[model samples]
Target: MNPDQLIEFLGILEKLKCNTRHNWSTSGRQESVAEHSWRLAVLAMLMEEDFPELDMNKVIRMCLIHDWGEALTGDIPAFLKTEADEKTEAGAIESLLEKLPVSLASGYLAMFKELSDLTSEEAILVKALDKTETLIQHNEAGSETWLPLEYELNLTYGDEVCRHFEKTQQLRDKVREHTLKIMEEEVRGHREK
Candidate 1:
C-alpha cells in the first residue's frame, strides 16, 4: 500500500482507540476497544507454549482484527447484540476493508470469514481467548461497575468456547472462581453497609 492509502486505512482504525467497551478498567475508567484488543492479542501471545501445534501468529492476527467492526458501530455488548446489529457491523467492516489495497483487503476478508466460521484451531483459540479476556476484565473491574446480570454472565460467558481447549477451560474456571469471590465480597459489603 502507498503512504496515502496506509494513512487513510489507519485513520479509519483510529476510531477504535476512541470507541469504549461496556466494561471498565481496573483503574476505574471505561475501557477502549483498542485496549481490549491489545490485551486480547497479548493474551493470545502468552499462550504460545500452550498451543504449540496452532498458528500463534494467526491467532494474534484474529485477536487484533476481531473488533475492527466496532470502530464503525462502537460496541454492542454481546447480550444486547442481535442479528441486525451483527449484519450492520459486518457491513461496516466490509466498507472499511474497501479502503485497503486489493491484496490486503482480500487477505483480511478471508481472515474475517475464517474468524466467523471458527473451524480452524486458530479461530477457535482466538474466540475462546476473546471471551476469556472479557471475563478477566470484568473480574478486574470493581463490582460496583457491574450490572446485576454481569455477575452471572462473567461466570458463564465463555464456558462453551473455553471448553474447546483444556487450558482455556482451566482459565475460565479460575475466572469464575474469582467472579464468585467478587460476588460474595460485594454482598458482604452490602450487608455491612
Candidate 2:
C-alpha cells in the first residue's frame, strides 16, 4: 500500500467537511456532507435488523463512501441534480479513485460502482437508508427546505425508496405526514394572524 497515495485520498475526503447539504441540521446550521454520511452510516447499522439477509458491513461502507464523490463534485441537492450533474459526479468518483493505490482503489471503486448500480441487496439497502436518513433529518429538524417544492418530497430519492425496503417506506410516509402537518400549522397560524 502506498502511504502517500492513501494520505492524498484522505485529504481529498476532508473536503466533505465543508461541502454542506441544502437541508439545515436541528441546530439550524447547514450540515456538511461528512456529517450527513456519518449519520447515514449509523442508520445503515441501526436498520440492519430489518434486512437480516444483507451484509451490514457492506451497507455501512457504502454509506460512508457514497457521498465521497461530493468531496470532489460538491453536494448538489437531490431535487436540483440533472443528468449532466450525475455525469460530472461519476467522473469525479473516477478521478478520486485514480489517486489511490491499485489494491485499495480497485476495492473502493468497485464498492462505489456497486452502490451506484444498486448491484446487490446490500447496495440497495444502503441506497434506501441514504434517502431515509435525509428525510429523517428533515423531519427532526423541521427543515423548511422542502416547503417551497411543488412535490411532497425531492424526486431524486423519494421515488426511488420504499420500492425495496418496508422500513424505508414506513419512514418515508412518516416524514411526509410530518412535513404536511408542519406546513398546515404554519398556514393556519398565518391565517389566524
TM-score of each model, paired residue for residue? 0.98, 0.90
Give the number of colliding residue pairs in candidate 2.
Answer: 0
- Model 1 scores a TM of 0.98
Residue-pair clashes, model 1: 0
Clashes of each: 0, 0
Stretch of 10 with least lDDT, candidate 2: 150-159
The true-versus-predicted C-alpha distance at residue 142 of model 2, in Å, is: 2.2
Give the C-alpha lDDT of model 1.
0.92
Choose the strongest candidate by TM-score: 1
> Residue-wise lDDT of candidate 1 within 13-85, one digit each (tens)?
9999999999999889999999999999999999899999998998899899999999999999999999999
- How much lDDT does candidate 2 score? 0.81
Alpha-carbon RMSD, each predicted model: 0.8, 2.1
Which parts of model 2 are misplaced by more than 4 Å? 154-157
Model 2: per-residue Cα lDDT over 67-119, one tens digit each: 88899889888878999999999899999888877887899999988987889
Model 1 misplaced regions, further than 4 Å? none
